[model samples]
Target: MTSPTTRSRTAAACMAVLLAGLAIGAAPAALAGTEDDAGLEQTVEAGEEVVTEDAVVTDGHVDVGPRFLDDEWTMLARDDREVPSVWRDPARTVLHLGDAAVLPAPDGPDYEFLGVEPGTPLHVVPQTQTPDVVWLGWNTQDPRVVDSVEQGATLRLDGLDGPGELFVFLQEGVTGPPNVLWDSGEPLPQELWMEVNTHVHANWVFTEPGIYRLDVTTLADLADGTQAEDESTLVFAVGQDTDPAQALAAVAADTTSDTASDTADEQTADGAASSDASPAADPATEVTDAPEAGAPSSDSGGSAMLVWGAALAAVVLLLVVVGRVLRARRARDAADQATGDAS
Candidate 1:
């Protein structure tokens, strides 16, 4: 048999050899260059393009896999930088917010837009512009912030020789929560679909006819021509048959009329509850009629009923407990009276 010291030395040698083998196996990964990697970049020269980088840019046509449902005030921008242009309508109208229709395109190399800096708090808020309009657009993507188009950038359309504005946003990434404001100054709506290195144009028309200012501002270190106000700010001339101020005044008047109607309704409700006179034969004739008999309740009565039922049950239980206490008191008093009579 081998001596204990000899066995120990052999065991130590084996351990050293195993460790050396592991180090040699891991060395290549640590020192490898991009060339050693499999399947590298596939740059396109405007021919039939395949889906590279999870993007569906086949046949020079970027297939935006799923179409985003639009809202009245849709968002268009990269991280912290909102597209300088947006739909002026409370509903989605393609005319106002489209950069290509107004601003001219640049003649230089294509510039990409970036959204969402790494480790930033990104959120989006979706709000309604009109009664029926919903805002929607691309947001942060898997690679977080990447490149796209620039908002407020000047552009030239094919037919219109003069230049106009160009607003751009990401193509695809995420579609919920923490919308990015293009810059730190103006905050756009919240709800937006996230896109990584993609570009999109928000299309819309002005609902109310008016000459609205096409506002553009940015703080990005983009190409010099697109920069404005330390960032960039541009205003386009919007000519409508109606004046913006006049249209706004009309909207205000309608709002006031609604407020007065609401006040009248409150007064009528109070009168009906406390007055001795019978209410008008039909409340429908006196005011806006309630929804149809089969229609869903406007007051959310289903949820209200559940709450009231729970409250009523609690009150009934309290009353029953009180009644039990009273009966117990009566029995105690009778017992005391019988004891006194016995005395």
Candidate 2:
């Protein structure tokens, strides 16, 4: 018969082996994937592997193109945990386009903010000398269960602050911005978006690290014949030096500053973002959707570079947590056995 200690050792060895196998299996998907090579005019054969790092941002701008291809979910649903106070709804509604809520999904993509807590902080995955990528998973929460969502709900991402074009994905959607219905007749151009119930995944690229905010607005027509529009402020911290609150305060100060030139420049940037055209002349803006040349561009490759990274990070974190739990349980079991043996 195997000694109890021997059995424990065997179990631990098996656990380590399990962890190794998981790592090996996941390494490729996590680290390698394809993106659109619009600038290169090269086609990534179906199932081609690529990396987002290849889409380098020179001069802190998104001028480079043959836009990257991505058909992946940056985060997925993980196991459930209780909500922390900071993450609970802030009682605000009416979100504009481009506004993103900063929530962590260090595990898998989140479902209704199910996998993360307020303090589940995130750093750029795959630690690098020049870390410009952030993988984020978020979900818009609607307490009102749709008895019947009459018109397909749409989420519009409109305004943006800071550099780099923002790309969001609906797990199964395309790599670029998700599909949207646009109308120039609106006060500002409009993008029709799929209404999100609990989770959305995205790859956030910041040509330069800083605080960024995208005004989010969601509108949906319900079965009750009432049109619902909710808007909220979503804050993001890009890199170690960013503070969302501080950025907001700075913008406020700049508003009342004597620097009229700075304000005009700001307006120009905002104007460019509101249009379908990209601020950069690079081919990245040459997407097929929206208005003609110089029109705002949106495309979806639905590739998997950032999706794998986020998934890998979540797996690693989950493994670590599981390992700790197993070790603690084994330690407790051994102690109990020792006491029983002594008795």
Candidate 3:
């Protein structure tokens, strides 16, 4: 049979164990909440927009490329001529092609890929910099982009709307064939792969002078096992007489309309019998939801420290409580033994 002192001691021991268990369990729940709150704060910060202004470049160096701005993949033009280089949104910027950019197509079979006759006048943004002309190029050297991207990125030409043909090619050596990246005459939606942390210049050829609009997109696989993509329109007034304002005001061509038109034309050519077949999906029109590229998950360290601290504190309190209960039990037992001896 258990005595009154034994019953009380058992109850106290059970209560202390239960309280310790609760403390241990509550620590994880509280840590989880703290982590969630930190994530929300980061999301809010990523959504904030950076202010930008309109810019027009007729001459001087400029790099049109992708960057992670506010933790979002963004397309912007970096004006290198600025004392502290300025980034301009492509939508609000215009590249003006002046008279100095006009040049005759080089005579040689190596240049035949340009689809222009020898000595034909072409508005050429040369691969090599011409001081009087706008030296346009691309780079993936942005600090954030270089850090987040796995290896490289893909630059896609979704559509081109202009009065003449456009060709973007690289001339590696003086005698070798030019490597074509995008040619308007070939097909739509051409892809150009660019290495991370690289800067490259290419020849931008326009068969005729007019306002041109290019729907460009950059896609990349990030280091965090996620993807990033951004689409923007690039406007160019490719002639001295062309107005930069007209290029700036130009809107991207409706890709959906073009796709529908092409489908109708194909069905017409194939006859009514083929109309029963389903149309293929348009890769360019596909939309995806991508989470913002965030800073590394190092913030969890703080929460982990808090959890450890809480666990330590709970363990110390439990030890102190058990020690007091044990000491009290010993004292009561000693007093009872002495009283029995006296009786």
Candidate 4:
């Protein structure tokens, strides 16, 4: 017959084995959670500072967006071209458009809205990142901005001055349709609504290469039952040959130019009345469609898949361990019963 001492020792051994198996199974899931928390903390800490120095960013990631500095609304560029991204004064930053930015315009009726001949060269800063070309986007993710703003803000393209037309558009997914945000061919002061804490990237297409200046404005309702508004000029040198100094010195474009152009077109029309007409209303301003805010970053989906995969693997291992433990217990029980009967 099995002694009480032997049975107690076997029970202890089984408990140890089960505990070790559980620890092994749970390790991966615990590690994944720790990593996710660290990533989120890093993002928040990275945006806590605003760098006041002038910078020229030709490559890597950068965001042109709005922020609150000392309770005042301001437009700035969040430069991530290097480690520890910081907010920069828009007037002091130059976004260089290099030769790597050039691409042949895609052939499709949908792209014709770009007002470019299909297959012609277009300088594009894509929504998705390219290694050598600068990845430019906008965000309202500054901690200060998020705390001050109510729900969101309105981004207005007040004016644009450039050698070629500019177009901004967003694609839903890899194969989704394009949603145009701002078109230089359209009227001035076009607005786009942006939810607070949103980080968004869009394709910036330039029809030709040269210096371009965009007059950008942000307006928002503050949490304190007040309104805040600010405007700044965003300058770009849109070619290797274009001088960054020229863009820095560029002034805000005359917002009245669009109205002037329309008036001139009316005068040249045959049999058209010479009466003075107001500039065409911007249809975009009335509807103000907001882009997909807080879209998952490229790595977010992959990270989620990895976490789920690890959890699944752990569960499978645990089930296998539990099954083995049950079978071993059953065998021990039968052996002990047979020995007792023999005794």
Candidate topping TM-score: 4
Write down the RMSD of candidate 3 (Cα, Å).
Answer: 39.0
TM-score, cand. 2 vs. native: 0.32
User: What's each prediction's TM-score?
Assistant: 0.20, 0.32, 0.59, 0.60
Candidate 1, 1-343: lDDT as tens digits: 4443544444334322212222111122223235422111122121122211111000111111111122111122221112222112221111122221221111111111212222221111111111112222222221211222232222111111112222222212122111222321223322233233332223122222232333322122223343222111111122322333443344346558978999999999998877766555665566656888788785778888989999999999999999999999999999999999998
Model 3: per-residue Cα lDDT at residue 23:
19
Worst 10 residues of 1 by lDDT: 54-63
The parts of candidate 4 lying over 4 Å away from their true place are 1-42, 251-343
- Off-target runs (Cα >4 Å) in candidate 3 are 1-51, 252-343
User: Each candidate's root-mean-square deviation in Å?
Assistant: 28.1, 40.3, 39.0, 39.3
Worst 10 residues of 2 by lDDT: 59-68
Query: Taking the tens digit of each residue's C-alpha lDDT, what string does model 2 give over 1-343?
Result: 4433544444334322212222111122223233421111111122222222111111111100011124211111111111210122211111111212222322212321222232333232111111233222333232232233454455455666654334332222212122223222234434544433322332332333565555556555667786665553344455544554565464455446736878888999999878857465658667544567764334322345667788999999999999999999999999999999999
How would you encode candidate 4's per-residue C-alpha lDDT over 144-222 as one tens digit per residue?
Answer: 8778889988889999988999998765443344678899899898988777776666678898889888889989999
Per-model lDDT: 0.29, 0.36, 0.71, 0.71
How well is each residue in 18-101 modelled by candidate 3, as lDDT tens digits? Answer: 122221111211142353222111101112233376677888877777877757888877777665676788767788888888
Ten contiguous residues with the weakest lDDT in model 4? 21-30
Better of 1 and 2 by lDDT: 2
Q: Indicate the TM-score of model 1.
A: 0.20
